[model samples]
Target: MWTTLFLSYSPIPEYEYVENSIPTFVAIGGFPFIAFHYPSPPMGSDVVSQSMWPLFYLNEFFWLIIGTILTKLLPQKIKNYSQIRLFCIVMTLIISLSGLGYLVLRFD
Candidate 1:
């Protein structure tokens, strides 16, 4: 599952901390560090960490619904402009909000 996510997110830039060193993928209690050479990350890991799960869930939920309806209900030749627009808008908002949540949680 996470591998799919990583592949899907391949367009993102490769940061040295996330790339070179052993990135802590999941942390139980303390702040989870992604950068290299870090055991327990600084305080406040839960802030962005928690937000990401919900955003990912929401995005999946919306995408599943949209994708299912498009595949099942739509005709082969016709395109649903409204649904496509809606999906795109929601996805963009989801990405933007998640990024914002990450910054706020990680830094502030």
Candidate 2:
């Protein structure tokens, strides 16, 4: 999923870290880290998972705070109109395709 998100993003040079790393980390948390909240990640995972749950949400809260600050301070984040349009187009296409693919997989 992160790979697909990256394909949609396709960051330009100046804002690469802001574009790539943030979403990647978010995706990692959304998927792998989230598994810890489920039944069990491993045989002995209960203790570890319980201990880590609060920290996960705390990390996400901090990330949101940082992102809010960055957006306020970095108004020129996108650099140009073309890059913005490209990002929108690519993300729209990827999301649409992914939704259709998911529906197909689910029903078929």
Candidate 3:
């Protein structure tokens, strides 16, 4: 989605200082599952912005609502399909593991 794309490419002012210094993975989905380094504020800078923190939780709630509505709207037949379930499980694992791998390699 647009949010993931924007977060990946756009320069968020709060993150500007540590952008290139850290590795970030914005998972592919309607809601971003972010895995990234949390950099401390630069030395001697006392202003630690908490603005982005609330947005992360807000985004999760928004997507939860959307997902609930979608599940209700979707037909049971489609939801019950083995292929769909398998695909979802596989994709989730792949994305989650990829993010984990990136973090591990980054720290190592």
lDDT of 3 by residue, 15-88 (tens): 44465664242222223544233333232123223544455466567766887999999777654588888998
Model 3's alpha-carbon lDDT is 0.48
The per-prediction tally of clashing pairs is: 0, 0, 0
> Candidates ranked by TM-score, best first?
3, 2, 1
Worst 10 residues of 2 by lDDT: 35-44
Alpha-carbon deviation at 14 in model 2, angstroms: 41
lDDT of 2: 0.43
Off by over 4 Å in 1: 1-78
Top TM-score model:
3
* CA lDDT, candidate 1, residue 35: 22
Candidate 2 vs 3: which has more lDDT:
3
lDDT per residue, candidate 1, 1-108, as tens digits? 222233343222236346556545323211121221112345444444454565556555665676798889767674788898899799888876775564454433
Q: Indicate the TM-score of model 2.
A: 0.30
lDDT of 2 by residue, 1-108 (tens): 333322332222444347433322111223223322222112222233445456546645665677689868976756588988999799979976884453233223
| Positional deviation of residue 2's Cα in model 1 after best superposition, in angstroms | 16
